[model samples]
Target: MCNIVGIYHTLPCCSSLTVSLRCSLLLSLLKVANYSSLDACLNLRWPSAESEILPRHVPKGYFVMQVLRRCPSNTSPLTLQHLKSVWKDVAGDLNVDESLLTDEDFLCCCGSSSPSVNAILGGVVSQEIVRAITGKGAPHGNWYYFNGLQCTTTVEWLPNSAISS
Candidate 1:
């Protein structure tokens, strides 16, 4: 398995350029972690996990998704199509099977390419209103599916007594 902490240390903060870089980085990590026999397309030197800053109570997969989903004010939101295009390019560059990068492997709930008109506003307020009205609506934050599994954005902290039980 690939060391996510090591990969995290090597990544730069989110910006337009950095977002693209991070995309490449994430794909590389996925390639390494998922495929053993395939040679990497990019000759990236992964860093050691010596100076890692861990996120609060998040798994490596969640942390990586957070990093991938970050869209700074200066950058446009990343679309699944763009990600797939990048994957294809990377596969071509690396001489690997493009089929390996499947939609089921990575799912991102980003805005659609075509614009649409909706009655309800979208944000925290919208989500709260929907929840209060219908008891169920959209999820709290951006949705991501990694390794064919979905993850919750929020984490609950159990009391120390509960943990001890």
Candidate 2:
């Protein structure tokens, strides 16, 4: 919300600015960045009045944060390592490596005999790209899945990593 931010910055004491004004300002900022609407960004809800402002505090070395901090950089080796860790968590320790895997690699454990898996996976990836570029819906950061049985598709998000040269 650039307009809101601008308005806030210019007129910090304007008490009459409504939520709609804030939203409008935010939308303007997104527009300048080539985004169309608020839905293009992740939806985050504010805490309700009844909710505690400070919940149970984390003691700094939380496991989730540790994993996040170790997220692979953009280098192929680092990406592969990240994928290995993800696969270990999801598929339980498959012997995956960087060998032929690119950052864009899409692997399906479905048997080689099943060409359907390839088609489905490709379609799912394409759909995700379309959604991301068109800003039609949420951005699919990295992973995607297609279930031929259910004819359903899902997208997964991955944290951004800083690759050292």
Candidate 3:
């Protein structure tokens, strides 16, 4: 059986560049977590355990998403503190106004892509996801690039040296 993997595509759209990077990260995060996913493409509201970080009520165009995963060997914890730090670090690097990125506000761009873009890119990501889970190809390495304008895609292996300590 193909090992399962999970993905979270909140579709952060600070800009095209960062959006592409974030999309790649969504795919990579799925592979890293090693859990099956539905691409977080829900069209309905749902409950969230991190409700405090979200708004009191989900706006009409908004919904809740919560994901929980386990480390393959039960080797470490995925605590709230760890996620908070990671989010802060990523926000700083992305030059995002952290305050504007709350769960309710952040999802503003979730379905903003053109239908054409979604069809093409969605298939590409889905195919890669299957390949990664079934051992047809290596799990999403560390980075990828998708240039919708150029109709091209590229994958990059991120070096540990590039990640800050």
Candidate 4:
């Protein structure tokens, strides 16, 4: 259960230059302006290969996390309009333009609650995203690490609001 802080502590300052560089670049891309946000963002479950400290595909998991956090509720299915609005909020929070994020970008469905083709986030299927976000196959927060270990990561639902930094 190695968190970002834990992993950072495991390595000498000079020994983790690559991790440092990746962190800086990812932090900028994700528009994390503070230390706390960086911690939360890095702690989220991401796709990774063996023993990788960071997620293999960060942006995909990150976008899914943001969407889930912004959702009004977890039980009720999310609507496209609501999803669009949530994306707008996400853009605002990241200080990016609304145009940069659209329902089409994520392939979210419009005017249909029934799940099907084109109903989920574009390339990333809704079920797969949910599974990863809930830590089924991916690493859970503090429950497992990206160090290629066999640990039981818990499957927890997303909170109603975004993770406070």
Candidate 5:
């Protein structure tokens, strides 16, 4: 099957989040450091989107520091409590040494990137933020790898602690 992303649930309230979007609908929201209001934010664009020669392999990490029983976090300065319980057993050598994984490695493996990569980033971030605010879906796991050129993304999730050890 073709690689598909975006909202695809068909139910009233669409989980109380606007209307139901079709199979693949990319939603994006832009935010900048400064003023307030979503619409009144600043505008930014890459001067040169074609500088890169190929698809870049970007290895990233994420974790749920804390799962709140409520919606928003009241504290301003939050902290990260590692999810070792979820990743330790099978995390393998994934991000064991992040130092060695560099842009050069990706260009050597994947293909070149386009200006649209930024658009992809915006959409993914927006999706996660929406899920967090509305509690409609779960965010990414502790690990993920993306090929910017091909626009291929993969997420790595650990076994639920309750079901594991």
Candidate 6:
């Protein structure tokens, strides 16, 4: 549960260095975990609800876009192999560990529903993105647990009605 936020004091600006720095920082944070523990590997963070001056003007009504992928947990091994193969074929590189699919960390969430590992991971990444884009909050990632049997959703943070305000 790592929450990270980057703040830009200045306004109306864009720089490759800034983007690169943010990406690198986030990646480093993610890479620190073992990725093996179902509890340890998951990250759940969100942006601040408070308003802050933007480094650059985001066009009015620019809604945040989210991309979601629902991957079957059982096919992770096959998926990893395919991704590695595709990378090798396209880039003529073979740096990825095809066996990682069998790693304990990688296979931690093979069978589960409600608050599935996939959802946890996705939520973590999404929260980080939100924190990076909106510079507010205590930098503590939030968590949610859902029960498939009970069909209940529990949220760590209250939903914000004025996210952009």
lDDT of 2: 0.38
Error of 4 at 151 (Å): 27
Measured against the true structure, the TM-scores of the candidates, in listed sequence, are: 0.26, 0.29, 0.28, 0.31, 0.31, 0.21
**Hey, what RMSD does candidate 1 come out at?**
21.5
For candidate 2, lDDT tens digit of each residue in 1-165? 322344224423334466567566655644222222333212211232322211122111122223333455454343445654654443222112223232333222122336777777777678877875665554443434454444566443322212221
Which digits, one per residue and each the tens of the lDDT, describe model 1 over residues 1-165?
122233235454546676676667676644211221212211211221321222232233332333344434356556666656666655564344566545644453353322212221234356666665653333232222222234333421211011110
CA displacement after TM-score superposition, residue 111 of candidate 4 (Å): 12
Choose the strongest candidate by lDDT.
Answer: 4
Candidate 6 lDDT tens digits, 1-165: 223343433223257666667657655544121112333212111223321223122211111101002233365543434443443332222122233222232222333434565676588678877976665453432334443434455433222212221
lDDT-based ranking, best first? 4, 3, 1, 2, 5, 6
Q: Rate the local accuracy (lDDT) of all candidates.
A: 0.38, 0.38, 0.40, 0.42, 0.35, 0.34
> Model 4 — TM-score against the truth?
0.31
The sequence of per-residue lDDT tens digits that candidate 3 reaches over residues 1-165 is 122232432353656676667666666644232322233322112233322223322221221112212122255455544434444654454333345334433332333456777787688788887876664444553434454445666543322112221
Q: How well does candidate 5 match the true structure in TM-score terms?
A: 0.31
The full ranking of all candidates by TM-score, starting with the best, is: 4, 5, 2, 3, 1, 6
Q: List the residue pairs that clash in candidate 5.
A: 13-16, 54-111, 54-112, 55-111, 55-112
Runs in model 5 deviating more than 4 A are 1-113, 157-165
Worst 10-residue lDDT window for candidate 4 reads 143-152
Q: Alpha-carbon error at 101 in model 2, in Å?
A: 20
